[model samples]
Each structure stands twice: as C-alpha cells, then as structure tokens.
Target chain A: MRGAAQSLKYLLLAAALAYPLMPFRDVYVLHVLVLIMVYMVLAMGLNILPGFCGLLDLGFVGFYGIGAYTAGLLTIHYNMSFWLIVPLAVLNGALFGVLLGAPTLRLVGDYFAIVTFGFSELVVLFLTNEIWLTRGPLGIPGIAPISLDVTWLATLLGVDERWRYAFRGEVPYYYLAMVMVALVFLVMTRVEDSRLGRAWLAIREDPMAAASCGVNLFAYKVIAFAVSTGIGALAGAFLARWTLFISPDMFKFWESFLVLCMVVLGGLGNIRGALVGSAILIALGEVLRVALPKLGLPAETRFLAYGLIMVVIMRFRPHGLFTQVAESTMQSSLIKDLRARIAARRTA
Target chain B: MLEQQLVNGFTLGLIYALIAVGYTMVYGVIELINFAHGEIYMLGAFLTLSFISMGLPLPLAVLLAMLAAAAIGVLLDIIAYRPLREAPRLAALITAIGMSIFLQNLAMIIWGSRPMPFPKQALPAFFSEPALTFSDVTISWMQIIIYAVALLLMVGLNLIITRTRVGTAMRALAQNQTAASLMGINVNRVISFTFALGSAMGAMAGIMVSMYYNTMYPTMGYLAGVKAFAAAVLGGIGSVPGAMLGGVVLGIAETLGAGYVSSPYRDGVAYAVMILVIIFRPSGLLGRAVTEKA
Candidate 1:
C-alpha cells in the first residue's frame, strides 16, 4: 500500500510536469493551476501559525501585500530584475513581521489574532491612502514579467547572442510556481522535523511546559513569524510579476480569511494538507464563480459556501481532512535505521 | 467645531459601546470573540427596515427588530458555537468568523448588496429636526434619540448584569466555567442569555446608526465589529464597563482623529488604537490583566 501510494504521488507529479508541454494544455487551466500554486504557498506559510504553532493569525495577507508592493515598487522604480526583487521583498516582509511580532507576540490567543487582523487592515489602509508611495487605489500595473537574464553565464561560455528569456504566457509561470511550491514545501517539511520545529510544537502544545523544557518561546515565535511572513512575501513577489498588477483591494481582509479557510480545510499543521486545500478551494471557487450565475445567485455568494464549509468543518472535523502532524518524522532514514536496530535487539 | 465633533463622537461611541458589550460578554463567558455579534447589529438595521416597510411604526419596528436580532444571536450560539464549546478555542474562533461571513453574505443575498435607505416615511419628522442648538453644535432629534436609547439600554444592561441571579451565574461562568457548571449554573443557557442581551443592544445600535446615517448595508458589520471589539479590548476584554468605556473613547478618538488628523483614513484610527492598546496595555482600562494561559 505504501509503495503504491508513493508511486501514485510520483505519477501525479510527473503528469503535472508534463502537462505544460502537452498539446492539449489549455491556457485557462494552466492559469488556474498557477493561481492554485500561489495560494498553495500562502496556505503553507499561513499553516505555520495556526497549524503548527497554535497561533491564529488573521492578518497574514498583510505580509503578502507588503511583498507584492515591495516587488512592484522596486521593479517599477529601479527597473530591477525579479531575482533581486524577490530577496528584497522577502527581507522587507520579514522585517515587518519582526516589527509587528516583537511587541504583539506577548498577546495571548484572540488578542494576537485581532492585532494581526488590525495590522492587515492597516496595511490595506496604508496602500490605499499612501497615494504618493503606493499610487493609492489605482494599483501598480504593467509590472515586468519574470525574465531569465543569464548573459553573464553565456559570456563565460563564449556564446555570441545575449541570453535573455522573458516569460510571455502562463506556462513559464506555471513551472515557476511549481518550483516555488516545491521549495517552500521542502523548507516547511524540513522545519517540521528540525529542533526548531519541535520547539514550536512544544510551544503550541503547552507554552509553560515548553518554557520549563528550556524552549525560549519568544525567540522561537519571532523566528516562526519571520519565516512565515518571509514565505508569504515570496508568494506575493511571484504574484506581482505573474499577475502584472496589484491593488490594495486585492489584499483586503477577505483574502486573508479565504487563505485561513484553506489552511483549516486541509487540516492544520499538515503541509500536504495545505496544498490539497488550496487546490480544492481554488477549484471550487472557480466552479462556483461559473456555476452560481446559472443558478440565479450572485457569484459573490460563493463565499457563503466557503463560510459554510468552515463552519461545517469546525463542527464535524476540527482536525481537518488530515489529522496527523509531523507525519514525515517517522519516515526519515534515521528513524528507519533506529527501527531496524530496535527490531534486531528485540529478536536477540 | 470641536464640540460638534465631540457630540458626534459621543453618539458614535455609544453605539460602539453597545456592540462592544456583546463582544466582551461573549468573550467573558466562552473566551471566544463572537465575530457574528457585529452581524447581529447589521441585522438589526435590516430587520428594522424590513419591519417598518411592512407598515409597523418606527418604535414597534425597532423593538421587533431587537427581539428578532436577540433570537438570532441565541440561535447563532446554539447552532454554530455550542457544539464546539469543549473544543480548542481556535475552533470556536474560526467558527465565529465563519458564521460572521455566512450571515454577512446571507444578508447580502436576502437584501440586495446595495445600501438601502432606512424607511424614511416610517421615521417621525421631528427626528431630523434639531433638538438642541448651541454655538456650532446642533444636536439633531435623532442624535438625542440615540443618546437616550443607548443610555437607557446600557443602564438596563448594567442592571441585568449586576442586580440579577442570571448575572451572578454569568459572572460565575466567566470566573470558571467548570466550577459554575458544577455549582448548578446552566452553562449553555447563560451563554445563550448573554448572547441575547448583547445581540439586542447591538441591534438597537444598528437601528440607531442606520437612522442617523439614513442608510444601511451588509458589510457595515465587518468594520464596526472590529472597532467595537477594539473598544472591548480597550476597556478590557471581559469587563462590561470596560467595553462601554472603551467604546466611547475609541469613538471619540476616531471622530476627532478623522476631523483633525485625516478624514480619508478614518477607519484606520480604530485599528491603530486597538493595536496600540493591545501592545502597550492588553489589560485595557477597566479589566484584569490578560495572562498567557490557555
């Protein structure tokens, strides 16, 4: 069963990688897939707070907005490459995360959540009102798409033509988004098994006990905030270039709630669940957007369904579709070797 | 100009106070921020509009709306929140947010998305007239009505909370739920009653605001709810009086800030205050210190 499941997973991945190259690939489907990947990154980033750390952050979209605006403004003003802009955006997001988290992490429970919500709202307000900076409500448009300028490498290799690849359609973004999702997923899973990850789990399960166990809750929480917000910014940077436009309204409170719903739906603390949740919810949203109008309901009422899904899930399956946390810890080669040693000792 | 802003701020503050009490009461009891409380206030306005249009007088319409809002609040608790009483606080909080979005969109569906004028024909002519005028401050009859109604309801709420057996049970529950349940206090019933009381006050505030502005919309609850929660947090999350005080302060600060600092960022003021207050003094002005437990 394990081998079959593993094979099926690889099969799905192989299919995804090949789909863009396939002749029958549709632009609309490709677009939706890329969008799903963007949200997948967001959900995974957000999952760190409520899922692993037991901290409900309602204002995560603030970081996403900051990252996008950082990328958007830097690209427009300085005419910088996406590669350099990503690091700058990520740094800006982590800086804001620390600035916000340092003082606010001491707030317990709902207070922390509300502060995050307020911070996000303020971010939107700033983006909307700071006309001199963010262009206010008009939003930045015509952002340059992600380009691969490897002319230096080409020069080193003695190539004649300048090596520059500009992304035109959704295909490049789809693959780029895939790479981003994979990278974030890898980081999250690795963190989920590391000492820092265990400390977070400790903090989540029992803060006082964790404190007694010599885990510095505040430092770890700040690290978690920086990492989570940094990933959120990474997604935002990708979005700014891919979408080619971003407005303050795009980062409203509703987007934060939507992403939170995705995190909860996929089962909190489970990285794979975040991916699945994003795909399902985004796909469901697309379906409802088209389907609702035919049924004489406004497309906006699809949120009614999203809201209902959350309520139902909370009442019925609060642990989400997946109930395990750190499921990969047991599957690590070190754990496998330990298991073998224990089995041999028992037989002896 | 300042006096006028103060009066305006005071009126707005009272309405916020009304909503804040609901959030504070629910939080005191369940330790969950009842995000749907704001929707109840929104429903209050919509229901009053619906009732007035159906030929009921304004007074009767407002009364009926409050009762209906109270009932809905109770149902919201029973249906959405009660099942997760023993679950983690996050579950209940998410459910509250879910219910909030559900009801807001449900309102949008029921009443079209556009802002509707509170039935003008249903209101008394005197409401729009000046009840008192002095210097640059002219208090409209509607403002006077808002003042009287909010004051009376808050006073009555204080009485219910301080001078009643149910109030004592509620206090007990806030202190410790398991102990209160063990001591024969019906936990769910008190929670429902708290919701009812808070929802009714919130509904009345909604009606008054819609009347003051002469318009109501579905999404009004989202921002108002946050601000009122801010008020509650400002006063102290679990204290009733704290919520009241917080509401007025926040309202005045908001109006004054809008008037003096910047008008376009009017909504940002409340958020800023809430964040500042939470960071500097999470205990708020009138409540106990919020410890990091559970």
Candidate 2:
C-alpha cells in the first residue's frame, strides 16, 4: 500500500510537470508558476536549517545574495558559462555558510537569530558600499540567459523548435526547477528519516536530553546550515538565470523574512506545506500588485495590508497551518512492518 | 583625531546603552527579546516630532514623547504579550517580530516614507549652537545635552533598580517568575512597568538621536535597533551596567574603525566585535551564566 501511494504521488507530480507544456497556456500564468517554483526552492532550502534544525535564521538571504552575486559576477564579468558558474555559486554559498555557522552555532535560541540578522544586514551593507565589486546600487545588468542547443536532439526525435517553444519559453525551466526541488525534497526526506534528523529534533525538543544521549549538537547544526545555505545558493543561481539581471535589491532582509513566512505558513519542515505556502504567498503578492492599482488603492497601502496579514497569521496560527509532528514513530511502524515481511518470507 | 573618534563613539554608545537597557531588562524578566521595542524607539521620535510640530516647547515635547512611548510599551504588553505569557517562547518571539513589522508599516502609512527634518530652532539659541571646540575637533552644545540627558537617565535607572521597592520586585521577578508570583507581586503589572520603563528610555534615545543627526527617517530605528541589540548581548542581555559597557565598547570600535579603516567597514567592525564576544564570552562581560532547568 505504501509503495503504491508513493508511486501515485510521483505520478501526480509528473503529470503536473507535463501540464505546463500543454498549449493555450497564458504567459502570465507561466510567469507566476515559475516564480512559485523559485520561492519553493528557496523556502525548502531555508526549511532545512530553520524548520528542521530549529535555528531561527533571520539572515538566510545572505547566502542567497552570495550565490546570486557569485553567479552574476562570474558570468557577467569573467564571461563564464552559466553551467560552469552554477556549481561555483553553490560552493561559495556553502563556504560562507560554514564561515557563519562555525562561530555562531555555539550560541542557541534568540542569540543565534540576532547574529544571523546582523550577518544579513552586513551582507547588504557590504554590497551597497563596496562599489568596486558589486557596482553598489547601480547593479549588474545584461546577465546572460541559459541557452541550450537542443535542435539536434529535437531533430532526432522528429520535433520542431515551434513545438519546443513551450520548452524554451518557460516549460523547461519549470521542469528543471521541479527536478531540483524534487531532489532536495528526497534528500531532506531521507535526512529527516535518518538518525541525523532525529538528532536535530531531539535538540529542538530538549537539548539537554539530546546531549546526554551523545548527540554532537554543534556538528549537526553546522551540517544543516551548510546544506541549507548551499541549496539557497543554488536557488540564487537559478534566480539570476531566470531574471537575467542581478542586483542587491533581489537579496534583502525582507526576502529572508518572506521565505520564513512561507515556511511558517505552510508548516515548518513539511515539504508539501512549504510548496503550498509559497504558492499562496507569491500569488497574494502578485494579485495585490496588479489588483490594488486597478482598485485605486495607494501603492503604499498594499505594504500596510501585507504587514497586517502577517501579524494576523502569526497571531492565529503560531504553529503554522501544517504542524510538523514527530515522524520517527511512523518510521518505526514502517520498519516493524518491513521486518515482519522479511520474517514471513523466511517462514514461507 | 583619535580623541574625536573616541568621543563620538562614546556618545553613540550611550544612546545604544539607553536602548539596550530595555532589551536586557525585558529579557532578564521574561526571556522575550521584545523585538517591537525598536519600533517603539521609532515611535518615540515620531511622537516627539509630532508634539514639537504642534507648537509644544522642546522640553515639554520631549517629556510628552517619553510618556507616550511608555504608555505604548505598557499597551503592547497588555495587548500582544500578556495573553502569550504561558505560550511557547517562539510564539511570543514571532508575535514580537510581527508587531515590529506592523508598527513600522503603520508609521509608514501615518507618516510618509521620506525623512522629516528635526527643527533645530525649537531649542534655545545657545543650545542650538556649538559650545566647545579644539584643534580639528568641534563639540556641539547639543552633544553635551545628549550626554547629560543619557547619563542622568542611566543613573536614575540604576537608583530605581537598586533602592526602590518596585525595583526590588522587578529583581525578584527576574530571578524567578513563579516565586515572585507566589509572593503576591502582580507579575503582570511588573512586566508592564518594565515595558513602560524600557519604552521611555528608548524614546529618550530616539529624541537624542534625531537631535544628533538633525533628521529622522522611518527605517532609522532598524539599524539602530540591531546595534542596540548587539550592545545588549555584549553587555550580557540581562545586565544593565553590562549593556552600558557593551554599548560604549561597540561605539568606540565602530568609530575608530571608520576613522582608521575604511568607513564602509564600520558596521562590519561592530558586528565582528559582537560575533567575537558571543563566541568567546557567551555570558557577556557582566552577565551571569544561566543553566537551563531540566
């Protein structure tokens, strides 16, 4: 039954991916979907650290900015290929994650959040003031887009570029993003099911007991930070490619907060919940941006509305819409079933 | 030249210490960081500016601003915090962040995003003028007023905490919440009073900051709040004198860093100091190490 359910889930995901390629799709809808995927990727990365590890990182965007800038500079200035620069960006982000997490992970609770907040602001300030590299506020422009010569592959398959328009336009990127998201989801699922994920939960629930049980709290936390930040950098690279422009404005403290909201709203540490959360938030932002102008609402009033919505959400659903429960017991039940199956096989 | 930097750093440090006191006191008592306190500081500036714009005298305006800020602080506790007293710490933390964002956006809606120029003419002519100068170092009368006001406020706070019965109750609550409650102390009232006191101090800091900079913007409190938070942590989050010490140290570090190193790196220097302090001395300079009860 479990195997069948898992297969059904994957099948549904595949169907959803293929649906975007269908004709008659509105360009604006495609655009919103692409953005939703982007945020989903970013929020998932953040979830590993803050949601799974229970580290309140108010400056998660620092890693995102680092990744975006890394890809932007390498491609724009050094004229490196997009494929070549992506890995470097992720590595750069992970390196900084280690640098930040190494010293600060020792501090727990609100102190950790404060340090991360400072780190995020420092990154923005650096990007703003250091005109020599970042070009300050003017920002980097004309970033090359990702292009692939799939005409030969198409010819082999007897398909024309016109039919491939969907792929070239938004469909391919959507699938690519989906693939990355799926891969992250798988890795996170495996990690969360493993002893390491349990260690994180143990630390989150009761650090003292976890410590008594021989969990190396600092080591696991740094690992989670490095992994999450590395993935955030990957998302940044994708964002640079998608927007085809890189600027300090793209990565700010508010961006981090938005990702946090997505995680909290969806249900921390729950992948499906995060996807739903990102979709809802990005949709709300887009709708507000478009609808408010038509409704004759002042531009600033939208921000006020956004703030009020956040306060309301926080006030009512502090645990988020989807509560993250301990999954270990469920895993144990599955393990017991598997063991029983093996014993029955031996008896038969 | 270094002396000027030192003086400037000390002045900035005092202002940070003033704000840090509220953070440390609240954290010491309830373990909540009160993220909205920074917004209260911003409100203090806005309230002061509003009162002065309404043709109130400068001193009277300042007093009114402080009182308004204190009242808001008390109101915040009553509305947002008091109900969440028994909830998880993370819940309260989220609410505080939410409140901070709400207050900031509210301010933006009420006052335009553009900065407002603080009226220098509202003060006495002599107070508005530069009072002292040395070779390449000019000290304004306003700076003197800021220093005097901040020092007096800190001293008064110290006296209130040490000598007064209310101060004794506050200390008792900080040490142990349940015990304090059992002793018939109105824990809710004490907490509200803490917020009010802290808000008043933050308001004073905001006013002095506007005078020092000669302008105020909606987002000014964000950075100042972060710096003040760093100061509070550096002094040990729950220690008053420690906050003062941390603020001065951070201020000096920031100013001297801008003077000697690149000005662009001043903020980095301050944060670096905070990171180093947290890494090496997690308890802060004056803070007592707390062990979690099982």
Among these predicted structures, which one has the highest lDDT?
1
lDDT of 2 by residue, B1-294 (tens): 988888888889888999999999999888888888888889889999999899999989999999999999999888887778876556677667767777876787677678998887786778667688888777788789888999999999999999998898999999999999999999988888899999999999998888888788777777788788889889988999999888888888888889999897777876777777777887998999854444
Over B1-294, each residue of candidate 1 has an lDDT whose tens digit, in order, gives 999999999999999999999999999998889999999999999999898889898889889999999999999999999898888888999999999999999998999789999887888889999989997799999998888988898899899999999999999999999999999999999999999999999999999999999999999999899999999999999999999999999999999999999998999999999999999999999999877555
Measured by DockQ, the strongest candidate is 1
> Which window of ten consecutive residues has the lowest lDDT sum in model 2 chain A?
A323-332
The structural similarity of chain B in model 1 to the true chain B, as TM-score, is 0.98
Residue B32, model 1: Cα distance from true site in angstroms: 0.9
Q: Candidate 1 lDDT (Cα, whole model)?
A: 0.92
DockQ of every candidate: 0.77, 0.42
Clash pairs for candidate 2 = none
Which candidate number would show the highest TM-score if scored against the true structure? 1
lDDT at position B266, candidate 1: 97
Runs off by more than 4 Å, candidate 1: A324-348
**What value does the lDDT take at residue B202 in candidate 1?**
97
Off by over 4 Å in 2: A1-24, A149-169, A291-311, A324-348, B292-294
